[model samples]
Structures are given as structure tokens and as C-alpha cells.
Target: MTLFRQIYSLLFSLFLLVVASLGYVQFTETQSFLTKQMESDLNNASTSLGLMLTPALEAGDTVAAETLVNVIFEGGYYNNIKLIWMVDGKQQEWNNPIKIDDVPQWFINLNLFKTIKKESTITSGWLQLAQLEITAHPGFGYHELWRIMSNTLIVFSLLFLVAIFTARLGLTWILKPLNALSEHAKKIAARQFGPDMPLPSTTELKDLVTAFNSMSAQLKHLFQSLDEEVGSLRKKNLTDPASGLPNRQYVVSRLNGWLSEPSSGALFLAKLDWLEEVHSKYGYQVRDETIRLLAEKLVQQLNEITPSVIARIAAFEFAFLVTDVEHDQISKYLQTLIRTINQEISKAGCKPNENFAIGVAERVGQMKVSDILAQADNALQKALKDNKTFHWFETTEQQIFTREQWRDNLSHAISNKKFKFRWQPIQFCNGDGVTQRELYCQLELGDKLTHAGQFMPYIELLSLGSLLDKCLIETVYEQKLLERNYEPLAINLTHQSLSDSQFHQWLNHFLRNAPQVERMCFEIPEAGVYSDLESCTRLCNIIRDNGAKFGIDHFGRQFGSMSYLQGLRPSYVKLDQSFAYYDEASHNSELCRAIINVAKGLDIQVIVTGIQEKAQLERFNELKTDAYQGFIAPPENIE
Candidate 1:
């Protein structure tokens, strides 16, 4: 039992025992007093009657003696009265039998007071005349004793009830602080640091509450400090101090990540044609100010396009990447940016034509980082050579589908449930086999199987992500894929599904009926999580409520603060593949370690992805990740 219950039970038992003991003592004492009182009255009555009847006996008046005995018997106090006298050597006797009235049989059967008899010799002037005897009836004594004991019991019962109520209130008041402390500890466990608890009047509880509050505050401060430190490190290592844009290393990492996937985007490299002249004529401060102004203008121009990265790659050059835009639109946007840059620079005291020369390289299919950068650099040289403001180095485009064809293909595939599923094992770093298998799927279009990379962009463009996710979940359920293995099956969730309330309700119902729901883990991309955190958090709660798990994919890819993890608290995070390429001495490696540390502090599992070799695996071993996934344990087609 709980401490409160134990204490309350003990107090109640003690009160019951006290009440019982006092009641027994009171009943016994009342019985003894009545017994004594009855005996004394019997003796006194016998003595007085003997004196009063002596005259009658001496007068030889049997009638007078009988009258005296009858009067005593009729008084109803005595149970029995008798008169005996000798006249002319003959004996006469008078007797009365006992009688009892209102007392109950059960009380009389208790025999609290026993039968008593007393006798006294009758005499006239110191001579004995006759014998007078009287026996006391215990009826009056039993009645008096029962009355006193019943009143005592009633009073004690009332007191006992009052005591129980008083104890209950007192215990609740005393234990209220303990309950508050427990709730406060739970909040701390959830990484929520709220206001301190009010101290109780009980000294011990007050001290305990004070200690808990102090510990909570300290933990809150510790996490805040860690978040701040991580933010500072990101700013120092990945961001350019001069222009407040991402540094070259950050952009390269991002580009490398994109290149690994079947994704297409354009890379723009811009060179300030007058930066050298301005620095030579003016000072470092003026050059830096001009660069910052240009960066600000670029941000303002491209603010509408998300999933874009702008970086300061060199002393006089800047680069940026944009995806999901048509080539024609990209060209027009670049022309507008070039014109805007010249106009803004003229205001900063630079010649308009001598402003910025830009180069553009189109990334189609999987290409090396060196190839894209070299192509952009060659375009930059061509622009400088031709004295043009900007030049586009367009590469051969892949066979593309129109939006109508994509919508038709995706809708048919989703509705027909024609998706092929593949499973990839995420193994433990200690080589203890697989922790779980990540699910990857492809759409079957006729005889061809199209990977998610080729179709997902279209799905997002068509706003069919929620429908596709629901289709995939239904397929998994119908296939009973969870029963194929004991390990959990991790599935990826799209941002649209997270935001869709209808999808949430459907998933909730599906999981409620799923016997192996615990064998499932839903993963959301890092971008999706940060894009709409409220929706993601709500979805996470629903998944967890159904006993499934939630994870973050492409972790560490975002440059935003990691503080969100405190609230989201996913079961695990899959590090973005770029971290696998970073060497131990690289600043990205340090940032990776910081990420691992913060995740570990929250007890979240860290799994590094894209580990192609044992050396890459060993590189992450220093970072103390919980698991790894990639070519080391390549994905397998689930049969």
C-alpha cells in the first residue's frame, strides 16, 4: 500500500482498538457498580424491614408481618421478599416470587449482573422474633448497566467516525505535497521545466519539494546551455561570418546529400567582378558591407522558394542551390537576380555593368560534387570571357513526364495498390544483428518499377502525399508485413500526412486494430518535422499513443536549433548521409558529435546512414551512435 494508506490504516486500527478497550472497560465497570448497588440496597432493606416487622411479630399479628413483606414486594425494586414468624410454637411463612419487566432477553442472557440474595435476622428489643429474607432482582441492575453501556457505545462510535474523517482530511493535506512532487518529476522527465512547487507546511516534505525544484531548474538550465552551445558551434563552423550565409562546407554537404538521391536541381555560382577593385580602392569594411548587402538582396529575391541554400563559397564568389523549378523559370529568376544585384550595387557606389558575373549548372540524375562545381566554374569563366552578366551551362535533360502524366500515373498506382516494397536493415553497431528494417517502396507503372525519388517529387507537387501514405499503410496492413519478422518495420511519413487530420484519424483507427502495431515505427524527414512542428508533434503523440514508435529521418541536415527534440522526443534519428563522408578532423564531424551528445542526453537512439565501408562505420564509432544503415547492410527485397 501507499505510505498514506499505511499511515491511515494504522491510525484507524489504533482508534478502533482504543474504542473497543474503553467500551469493554465502561461496560464492566457499570456492571460492577450496579452489582454492588443492588447488593447494598438488598442488605439495607433487609435490615430496615427486620426492625419494622419485629413489632408485628412481637404483637403476634401475622397480618401485619405479611403486610410489611407485601409492601416491600409491591415496591417492584426487590425480586423476592419473605417473612417467617413463630407463634404458639407454630411457624407461619410469607413469600413473594421474583418478577422482571422491560429488560430484553438478550441483555438478560448476557448476564452482566448475576443473581444476588441477602438475609437479616428480625428481633424486638435485642431478641430475635422472626427471620426476614429478601433477594435482589438483577433486572433493575441489568437495565441501568445496559443503559449506561449503550450510551457509552453510542458516544464512542460517534467519536470513532469523527476521528476517521479528521484523519482522512489530515492525511490528504499532508500528502498533497508528495503528489505535487511526483507530477513535477514527471514533467522533468518529459523535459518540461515549469514553475516550482509551493512548499508544504510539513518540514520533511518541504525540504523534498525544495530539492526537486532545484534539480528541475538545474536540468532546464543545462539543456538550454547545451542548445545554445550547439547553436554557437553551428554558427561558427557552418555559417559565413561576413555575409551571414551558409559557408561553402555546409552547402557542399547539402549538395552531396542531394546528389546521393535521384534528385535534380540547379547550382548558381556568382562572382563579384568589382569586389577586388573595391577592396583595393576602399577598405575591408566597405567590401564586407557590399557583400552583406548583396547577400541580403539575394535572400529577399529568393525568399519565396524553400528548400534552397545560399552560401558564400569564396572570397569573391557566392553559390546557391534550388530544386523543383523549371529550367525556363530558373533562367528568368537568375536574370532578375542579376539585374537586382547590379541595381543594389550601384546604390552601394559600384558601377552597374561591373557588378556580378554569374554561372549556372543544371544537376540531372546522380552526379559527382566535383562535376557540378567544375561545370558552374566553367560557366563563370565563359561569362567573364564574353563580358556577359550571366551564362547558363545547361546539361542534357533526362526523359521527363508532364504534370498530367505524373498525376495519372500516381493516382492509378495509389488506387490500384501497385507499389513494390523493399526492406533495409538498420543493424546495431555492436553487430548484434538488425534492430529494425526501414521500408522503401516503388510504384509499378506497367512493366516498370519507378523508385520513390522519381515519383515523390511529383506526388508532393500534386498534393497527393497524404493519399499515397494512406495507400502504403493499407498495403502494409493487408500484406501483414509486420509478421514477417520480429523486428520493427520503419515506415516514412510525408509532411502532408502529418498535417492531414483525416489521415490522422484513419491511422489512429488502423493502429487501434493492428495487433502488431508495436512492431511499426513511423519516420518523418527532418525538413518535414521542422516545416510544421505542431502537426508533427500531434502525429507523434497519436503514433505513440497506439504503442508504435516515431523517428526522424535526414537528421542533422537542418541548420535550425536542435531544441525542438526536447519536445518532439522521437524514438530515434537517422543522421543525414553527408555525415558519413566527413572526416574526424572536419567541423561537420564535431557538429555530428554534438548532435549525438544532445540526442543521447535525451536517451534517443542515433543511427548513422549511408555507411558504405567499414572505415566509414569506424568513423561514426567515435561519435557513439547506436546503429548504422547503408551498403554495409544494404536493403533487401521482402519476398
Candidate 2:
């Protein structure tokens, strides 16, 4: 019905015509060749049998004649050598029935249906004794032809098997380069570039390898030239964008890895009671600046305690990991110092008589990063909730032992490489309705797994954050991407990692190793984006340059006033636990609506996370959000 049909039909007709012409030539030439071969062999064998029979007949030995026939058949070299006695014009006896073994069934069956008919005269003592004809029996004619067919097949089979085996070996060599080319094409289509596969042994494949390497180098150049967010590290995380306190995450990670050590200490953790009022009256930033002044005062106070660590741990909370304190005089002396620090901060700060609550905690007997801090944290929480001036969680022997055990297990998990990653799905409103899960690193302890939120501080303290991040990205590629074939996975990033030039180089190098960074969605925590805005921006640029897309994790409660994100846009943003669980029933808060609208205006899709119920899904659907992640869709099936 079309040009394609007409062309195809003509080609098919031509192919059939060729096949028929060849088959006819083969058939005509084949029969004569088979007939001559069979006739000559049969005639020679009969003559040989006769010469042997004569000796037996001259001896008048009937048994010898039968024995001679038995030997001829037993030899089996000739396809046929049969003896027959004509009795009253009917075959009375025969010997050496012909059959060719190790031949194909089709040849046997074909020959079994065709034959030749001819006769010869037999002589005894130079006188004709009987007229003998070698005509095949009507039913057995095919068997004669079968013998000829078997011989013909035997010749060709050896050639065919050799050719097939050779072709298979050759194809394996050729396919190597083709396979690598296909992989390169796939990577390009996915908006990622990876290393070329090993070249084949052929010249053609070597050329392909050269071309692919050139392409990959070009891509790498294009990337490094475009990244500008990594402005300068001299003032890294010096100012916390949210509360303008040196950002606890940055300070703590540094302290845990490179600063905190075994020493006599009297660290103080304090909570501010006036932050909410200031924030409520003025704004989050106004409260943040008040917090900033408090942070500066604490830092200045710590200089008096010199070589001590002080950082703002939360919205209105700060901690000082202090050392060089006498153990026995700690109770009375630290309390006096706390009073002095509060006195200075309160006198300079705004809001009349804005009292600051304080807590004191200490470490004893081989102090651990988390255990020591936990004591201060517990004391801080209690004092702040009650707005107390100072309180402490004095360590007991049992607390010390329990803390020791956790340290052992945590160390073992890292040493033995016994952690696993789970994906929290980040949905996109790509309108394609295709949603995929993003893998986040977490430990898979026997019978009990823990996320970063549960134990990352300890890891940060150990200075293993970079190692941990590398392990996660590598494992996801090997286990989930290549081995398990997951479509994509989301990975988290840290400020320390973004600044570590050596580690960043290692990651880009690793990505070039194949199927590693192709589907990776590196997530910068939404809070981090707000807290350490510069670091987050730099991280996005680095990740993009490495051929990865960035997703904002816990993507809300921020981005309200940031203009930087407008220029350095991420591919997706996951709603924070609070925003994801926002109240949705017959109405929407203006703030909630504003968040969606703003993200939408930036062309950034929103993912509603923590959706554990059907009501949440319906609500997300009502809001017309891009995608939803939670128990409503189990992560495993999507992966």
C-alpha cells in the first residue's frame, strides 16, 4: 500500500528467485554425483565379494560364502555390499544390509524416498549361472538414495560447523566496541558523561575509544569553566544566614574532627529565652542578630577561657566545649564564670532584662564526643525548659560504661563497612507522572537501623563525614545503580565535603568510572542552604559540574528571602517534615500558598515528603504539588 511495501515486496521476490535457481542447480548436479559415487562403490564391492566367493565355491563351502557376506557387512566401510540368491525369480537370501551411521536424519529420510534401478549378469566358471539385477526393492528404493544423501551431508557438515564456530569467536571480538559505544550514547542521553569502556582488539574499536575519550574530556572542560559558587573559603560559614551565629553544624564538625580531645574541661551550654519574643516582635533576622551578638559575646568570653570551642547549636541555643578546668573546683568555679558571661551578654543586648538560661555538663573517664556532649545537652534541655540559670548532668560510672559500648559499635560499623543506604523518594512535577526514589545513606545495624540524624554528630566528631559520604555515593553506584539497577538515588552533602578540594576531585574522578553519577541527585539540606548559604551554593555548582543534579532536602522553612537561589537553581526541592505535614483541610495558609507559588515561579518543582497517610496524599494532590514521598508509596517497589 506504500513505497516501503513495494520495495520490500520486490526484494523478497528477488531473494526467493535466487534461492530457487540455486536449489535447482544443486538438485540437478547432486543426483548424478551421488549416483556415480554409489554405483562405483557398489560395483567394486560386488566384484571383490565375487573374487572371495569363487574361492569358497571352488572349495564347495556354503558356510564360507555366508561367512564372507558376514565379514563384508561387518567391515561397514562401504555404504553397501549385499549378496542375494535368486530363487524362482524372488529374493531368497541377502547379506550385508547397508546403513551409514553418523549422518543426519533429514538426509536419511530424503534418500529413503528415492532410488536407482539397474541390473547385472552374474557368472560362475566363465558361464552365466544367473541374471542378477541390483535394482532396489520398491519400498527400499529410498534407502539406496538415503545412502547417497548421507555421503553428501557428511562432506558439508564439517565445513558448516567450522564456519559457525569461527563466526561466533569473531562476533565476540567485534561486539566489545559496539557495546561501549552504546553505553556512551546512553550516558549522553541521560545528560551525563562517563568513561569509555575498554577498547576492542580491532582497529575500528581503537578509533572509537579515541573518539569517546575526546568527547569526555570536552565535557569536563565545559563543566569546570561554568562553576562560580566556590567564591572563597577564608570566611567559610563565618556568618550563619539564619541566626548569624557561626552555624553549629560547621563549628561542631570542625571541633569533633580536628579540635576536641582528652583534657580537663568545663563546657557550658546555654539556651536563650528571649529569642521567640524578639523574633515575634521584629523578625527571624532581628532575633538572629540578637543571637549573633550573643554568639560574639560567648566567643569573646571563651577567649578568656582561651583555646576553648564555642558554637551556636540551634535557633536560640549555644554550647561551649571548654577545657582547662580543675575537676574538684568545677561546680563552684564554672557557675561563677557562667554568671559573669551572662552578666556581660545581658548588659549589651536589646530587650530589658532578657535573662539567659544556662546548663553545665562534664565528661569523665576517656570522654567520647557524643557522650560528653549528651551530658551537656540533657542538662541544657532541662534548665532551658524551666528557664533555670544553671544545671548539670554529672556523669555516673554506669553512664560512662554505656557510652563506651556505643563508641565500640559505632567504630566497628565504620571499620568493617557495615552500613547501608535507603532512598527517600523525591517526587518531581515534571508532569510526566514518573516518580523515582533517591537513596540516602543510613546504617543498617542488625535488627535496628539508624539514620544520620540519629548518629551523624558522632561521625562528624570522628571526622569521618567525608569518608562516610564517599562510601555512600560509591556503594549506591555499585549496589543500587549497577548491581541492583535502580533508576536513580538521592545522596546528601556536607559543608566540610564541599570545601575539601581533594575529596571533591576524588568524587569527580569516581563519577567518570561509569554508572556512578549518572542518576545521582546530590541533596543539600534546606536548612544548610539557609544557614551556610555560600557553601550550599558552591556545593550545587560543584555537583552540577560533576554531571549531577542538585535537590534541596528538607526544602522549606527557608528560600523565603534568598535571591542567590534564583540564579543557581537546583533541579528539585523536597518539602521539610513540617511543611510536608502541613494542615490541609478545606483551606490553605497564605504562607503555605506563598511557598508553593515562589518555588513554582523559580521553575523549581516541589516534593511533599513524610506523607504517611491517604489524607496527606489527597491534600498534596489538592495543592497540585509536583510529587509526594512517604509510606503511601513504599520506596523498594519504585527502585
Candidate 3:
């Protein structure tokens, strides 16, 4: 029971005891007074009757005496009256039986009042004639006692009820501050530090509220400090201070991440050959201003094309990583980008195309980072040698299917449910065992299974991501894949799925009937989360309501703020795989450490991905992550 209820019960019991005691005392006192009053009336009556009967007895008129005694007995105050002659000891007796019909039998059975008898001597001028005896009836005394107690009980009952109501109101008033404090504590536990609780009037409660507020404020300050520290670390290491674009390290890590998968993209390297001339002629300030202006113009032009990464690789060179664009449109986009940069620099009194050159290298399948970089560099050298504005280095390999072919193939596969799943175990840092298995989906085309990295781009391009998610989730549920063990299965969700209300409804219904629903964790990439945060937040809440978990995949892939983690608190975050390639002394390693510390401070588990070797595992283990997943224990085919 709550404190209020406990105190109220004790107070109620005390009130009942007091009321009962008062009632009993009132009943007893009334009974005693009534008993004494009855006895006095009986004694007076016997004396008066004896004196009256004395005259008759002395005159030898026994008949008159009998008549007087009969009259007195019929008065109903006395139960019995007797007159006896002193000479012959002859007795005359009149009796009346007690009959109390007004009072209940149960009250009379208590026998609260006793029968009172009185005796007196009859005399005529100081001479005794005969002795008189009278017995008073106890029925009247019992009736009066019962009436008084009944009234006292009704009065006390009303008072007791009023007292109970008043006590309840008082308790609620006094405990209101405690309820507020409890809610504040719950918010603090959730890592949501809002405001201080209002102090209560009671001194002790006021003190407690003050302490709780102080603790909450301190925690809020600590989390904010940690977030700021992480942000500062990211800015210091990964961002270019001059143009505010990403530094070379950040772009390289992202490119390496893409290269590790069966993904396709193009890398462009742009050089401003006039930067040295400007620095020597117009000074460093003008040269720096030119670079900053060029970066701003490039950002604006690229923003209209697609999501791409722009980085300052060198003082005069810039790199662009563009994905999800068709191979045929690469030349057209690069031409427009080169023209825009030339036009922007011309405004600074520099000639267009006189010193600007760009190189492009197309990515088809899984390729090494060095090969792509070298290819782009060769293209840049050719552009400068041939005095061309830009040059494209296209790879021999191309996409396997056209847009129409991909649509037909993906539609048929989704309809036929031609998908296979593999489970990758995420082991604990302590080498205890598998914590959970990350689910990887593959498309079944012909007799071969195609990896997600090969087909996911097309799925997203066709806006079939939501359908694909539903197909995979339904297949997993129907196949009872979750029943193999208590370990949870983590599935990655797309931005389309998170934003689709229909998908949300379907997932809610499906999970409601799903056995072991709690053993499921749906994850979204950091890019997907930031794309539509409101939708992601709603989806997270729905999944949590169904007793499942939510996670963020590809964490730190985007340079967006980490403040969203405070509100969209996922169960865990899988660091972007690029961090795995950097060594312990590298700036990326320090960046990784900062991200881990920020996440850990909020009680979020951090899992490092792409640990393909023992040395990599040992290096990341020093960072104190919760778990690791990669080729150290490659993904296993689920039977």
C-alpha cells in the first residue's frame, strides 16, 4: 500500500476506537442513572402507600387496604406490592409480571438494569401497623438505556464518516508533492531531465525535493557536457575548419565503407590549379577566400543533384562521393558541377576553365579503396595534361539489369517471397557468447542468392523498400525463425518502412500475435533516422509498445547531430564499419572513442562492426564497446 493509504487506515482505526469508547461510556452512565432513579421512585412510593394503608389496617379495614394496594399495583411502576399484618403475620400480595414490548429482546437480554425492591413500615401517629414491600420494574430502565445508546451510535457514526473524509483530503494534499517527486524520478531514470519539482510545505518533504532537483540538474549537465564533448571531437577531427566541409579522413572512411559492400558509386576529384598563383599574387587571405567560396558553390550545386559527401582533401583539391545516381547521368552531373565551380570562381576575377580540372572514377562492384583513388587520380592527371575541363574514367563492368528489368525481377521476387536469411552473431566483448544475431537478407534470383548490398539500391530506387520489409518480416514470423532460441533477431528497417503508416499498422498487428515478439529488434540506419526523424520516433514507440527493441545501424555514418539520440533512444547502436579500418592512434579511433563514450553515458550499448581480424578486434576491444560483429565470426546460413 502507499504511504497515504497506510496513514489513512491508521487514522481511521483510531477514530473508530474513540467513537466506540465514547458510545460505550455514554450507554453505561445512562444505564446507571436510570437504575438509581427507578429505585428512588420505588422507595418513595412504598413509603406513601404504607402510610395510607396504616390507617386502614389499624381500623381493621383489610378490605380498604387491599383496594389501595390493588390501585398502586395497577399503576405499573412496581412489579409486586405486599402488605402483611403484624399481629397474625397474614400477608396480602399483588404481583405484576414484567412485559417490555417497546424494547427489542436482544437489548433486554443484556440485562443492563437490575430489579430494585424497597421496604417500609406503615405507622399511624408513630405506631407501626403493617410492613409494605414494593419491587420496581427494570423494563423502563432497559428501554431508556437502549434509546440513548442508539442515538449516541447514530451521532458518532456521522462524526466518524466526516472525520474519515477530512483525513483523506488532508492526506492527498500533503502527499501531492511526493507524487510529483516520483514522476520526476521516473523522468530522470529515462534520461529525460526536465525541471525541478516544486517544494512542499512540509520541511522534510521540501528538503527531499531540493535534493532530488539538485541531482537531476547535475545529471542533465553531465549528459549535455558529454554530448558537447563528442560534438567537439567530431568537429576537431573529421571536419575541415576552412570551408566547413568534411576533412579527407572522413570522406575516405565513408568511401571505404561503401567499397566494403557490393555497392556502386563514383568519386570525383577537383583541383584548383590557380590557388598557388592566387596565394603568391593576392596573398593567403584571398586564396583561402577563393577556396571557401568554391566549396559553398559546390555544396549548393550538389544539393540539387543527390545526397553526396564533399570533402577538402588538400589545399587546392576537393573530393566528392556520389551514390544512387545512374551511370549514364554521371557525365552530365559532373559537367554541370564543373561549370558551376568555374562560374563561381570567375566572380573572384579568376578566368573560368583556365586552371580548374575534375576527374571521375566509376564504381561498379566491390572494389578496393586504393584502386578507386588511383583511378580517379590518373583521370585528374589526364584532365590537366590534355588541358580538358574534366575527364571520366568509366569502369568496364556495368549494372546487371535495366530499370524495367529490375522492377520486374524485384516485383516477382517479393511476390514469390524468394528471400533467404543469414544470421551474424554479435559476440560480447568478454567473449562470453552471442548476445544477438543480426539478420542479413538475400534475394533469390534464378538458382543464386544475391546479397542485399547488390539489390537494396534498386529496391530503394523503386520505392519498394516498405514492401520488401513487410515480406522479410512476414517470412521470418511465419517460418518461426524466432523460435530457435531466446536470443533476439535484429532486422534493419528502411526509411520507407518507418515512414509508412500502413507498415506500422501491419507490424503492430503482426507483433501482437507473434510468439517471442520481445526477441525482435528492428534497426534503422543513421541516415534513415535523420531523413524522417518524426516517423522514426513513432515507429520506435510502436515497436517498444509491442515489447520489442529498436536499434540504429550505420551509426556515425552521417555528420548530423547526435542530439536525436537523446529523444530517439534506441536499445543499441552499431558503429559504422569504416571505424574498423583505422588503427588505435588514428584520429578516427579517437572519434570512435568519443562516440562510444557519449553513447555509453546515456546507457546505450555500442557495437563495432567489420572487425575482420584478431588485431582489429583487440584494437576495438580497448575502446570498451559492448560487442563486435564481423568476419571474426562470419555470418552463418540459417537452416
| Highest lDDT scorer | 3
RMSDs, each prediction? 4.7, 16.1, 3.9
Q: Report every candidate's CA lDDT.
A: 0.82, 0.57, 0.84
lDDT of 3 by residue, 1-639 (tens): 978889999999899889888887887789889988998898778777877787789898889989888878787778888878886788988888878877888878877777688887777776677878888988778778878887888888889889999999988888888988888998888788887888888888888999999999999888888778777877899888888899998888988788875566699998887777788889988888877887888888876776788999898899999875666556667877878887876777778888878999988666788989999999999999999988888567767788788899999999889888899999998988988998988887777777887687788778898899989998888788899867899998876898999999999898888878889999988987877889888888889898999889888888767878878889999989898887877777777888888788778989988888888888876678989998889989989
Worst lDDT 10-window in candidate 3: 324-333
- List the candidate 3 regions with Cα displacement exceeding 4 Å: 37-146, 198-207, 261-263, 274-281, 324-336, 351-354, 385-389, 505-515
- The residue pairs in collision within model 1 are none
Q: After superposition, how far is residue 329 of candidate 2 from its true place, in Å?
A: 21
- CA displacement after TM-score superposition, residue 145 of candidate 3 (Å): 4.1
Residue pairs clashing, model 3: none
TM value for model 1: 0.82
lDDT of 2 by residue, 339-453 (tens): 5556655554544434566678765555545765677778877876776667777666332123345467667776666776555454553446445566655666667666554
What is the lDDT for 116 in model 2?
43
List ranges where model 1 is wrong by over 4 Å: 37-154, 189-191, 196-214, 262-264, 277-281, 323-346, 349-358, 378-397, 501-516
lDDT of 1 at 524: 92
TM-scores, each model vs. reference: 0.82, 0.42, 0.85
Native-to-model Cα distance after best TM-score fit, residue 618 in candidate 3, in Å: 2.8
